[model samples]
Target: MSGHSKWATIKHKKGAADAKRGQMFTKIIKEMTIAARMGGGDVEANPRLRTAVLKARAANMPKDNIERAIKKGTGELEGVNYVEMSYEGYAPGGVAILINCLTDNKNRTAADVRSMLSKSGGNLGETGSVSYLFQRKGLVTYDAEKYTEDQILERALEAGAEDVATSGDSIEVTTTPDDFESVLTGLEAAGLEHDSAEIAMIPDTYITLDNDGTRKVLRLVEHLEEHDDVQEVYTNLDIPDDYDPDAE
Candidate 1:
């Protein structure tokens, strides 16, 4: 879990940089459109849509663009009929990889994803291949400086969080998916702010790699994430303990 937490922290920091480039906004809107289309456009009735919209707002996505996405999903306007898909694979060092995508054409997306994987020394697997190695959990991350650990632990436990831990300058709260919103709401009511909150796939076990292998795994994950159709990439790679962000 700690390894997954580190990966998440790095991913979040990188995502913030991607947002500045405006490339990540496309993924956010696609997610919102798909969420709204699957469930109703009403955020109150759709937790997924609510989360997607919240992320978009946090990213400062335009209000009109958000509204237009909802409209398209609700059929108020015609839009791309995206289909949600997940691809399973392995990165370098046998690290399990799960790729989530939203696309109108499965064939094209699959081909592109497969090619990318093959070129990167990975091979797509059958459904449920590596997926079983991961469990869905709600993760909430906070900057440690924002609150005392005792305070966060008390509120989070009282609000149904299963676990809370501090890593460096960050504190992480974990909960079952069913208890996520409730815990988040409780935190909000208590005026606690989180750095990031979302339901994510946590690996059952992680594969540790040396410097070379870690770099290869990271490159493969980064490449997959850059694809326009790819939304999220989950992996079980435990980043090397000696990794120095500034050294790279």
Candidate 2:
């Protein structure tokens, strides 16, 4: 598993707490609304909306909330007009960072992101500056404790997954964006439960930093994620296997 993948697993474990505060729901709602507006509310016909709906279901979002968000997107009910925006930047150790957001006010979101970066010993870069370091890919992770490597390897590849690798305590499945849903469904049908699944901006190369540097970069990431408009934060920082995020 890459450092970012480890971080994602940690975040997934922390998601219940975040969801209790409604932070997770807020982000997912925005994503669903935007997906519906752009691709329409028909899940079977709109791939983007289908993905968003699947994420909402995975998060245990209420059926009523999901329907309302789709309605808002289709203009059946009033909704905020969100625009998708991405920011490229570098963290404390020159590790590349990409922040994806959906917001009604780009100015506020941009300024807030810049402030968070600057305060954390980082700076925003030009549009394509750090983006070139990442690629969009479909990633699905399963708990290593519950599933064997061989079991995942056979089922994942048979379902059209590109690669399956064991990293730390997790099994990572990689796929093209087009095949993500099918691969996920296949795994589910085969009785494999996943920890996290998403279409993510994955870094091509990762940078390893010392403890203090890692802490600083992660602090910045947490702050960005707390913002209402920020949806996802991607970075190239490779966290060491034994590093405990809660240890000072």
Candidate 3:
């Protein structure tokens, strides 16, 4: 969990950078559209859509834009038909990688992803190759300042969370995928709001990296993330606790 926490911190920092560059909305809108298309647009009835809506709100996306994106997804208005695809691969030092993408043209996205991986000293693998190293779990994170470890554990455990870990400045609560929505509801009822809540790929084990190894892995992830269609990137490289690229 400590390893996961370190990556989470890095991801949040990177997300802030993306938001400033006007890239955040594009990704959020893609999520909204796909969620709406898969499930009905009624957020109350669609758990995925509800999650995406919350993300959009957190990002401070305009309400009108979210609605329009949902409408487009539901075919109430014209929009591109995006499909979800996943690619599994390996980064340098044998670190496993999994990428989630939503795109209208699968071929273009695949070619671009392959090119990026090769350029970054990684290579694409067949489906299920790297995915076997990860488990899909629901992760809900809160700032440590918001609650004590005991407090979070008691409430989150009673709320159906499977595990709770406090590392660095954040506390992460994990739940079975099926119990995620219920646990989230229970947490909200307890007057708590999460810093981040979503389904994530949790690696069973991590390969700790030195400064050079960390640089290689992070560079690969950044390139993968910068692609227009890639929604999420997961890697098993555990950054060294003392390594803070931003502080460099």
User: In TM-score terms, which candidate is top?
Assistant: 2
- Candidate 2 segments whose C-alpha is farther than 4 A from its true place: 1-21, 244-248
The whole-model C-alpha lDDT of candidate 1 against the native structure comes to: 0.81
What are the Cα lDDT values of the candidates? 0.81, 0.84, 0.82
Best first by TM-score, ranked: 2, 3, 1
Q: What's the TM-score of each model vs. the native?
A: 0.90, 0.92, 0.90
Q: List model 3 lDDT by residue over 1-248, tens digit each.
A: 22344545555544423423357688889999999999989998998898788778877789999999999989999999999999999898889999999999999999999998898888999988989888898888888887887888889989998888875677888888889888988998999878888888988888877777777788878877778898889887776658766554
Q: Candidate 1 or 2, higher lDDT? A: 2
Positional deviation of residue 179's Cα in model 2 after best superposition, in angstroms: 0.6
Tens-place lDDT digits, model 1, residues 1-248:
23335544555534422433476788888888888888989998998998888778767789998998888888898899999999998887788999999998999999999998888888999999999999898888888787777888889988999888776567888889888888988987888988878788888777877777777777777787778888888888776557543454
Best by lDDT: 2
Mind sharing the TM-score for model 1?
Answer: 0.90
lDDT of residue 205 for candidate 1: 79
Cα lDDT of candidate 3 equals 0.82
* Per-candidate clashes, comma-separated: 0, 1, 0
lDDT, model 2: 0.84
Worst 10 residues of 3 by lDDT: 12-21
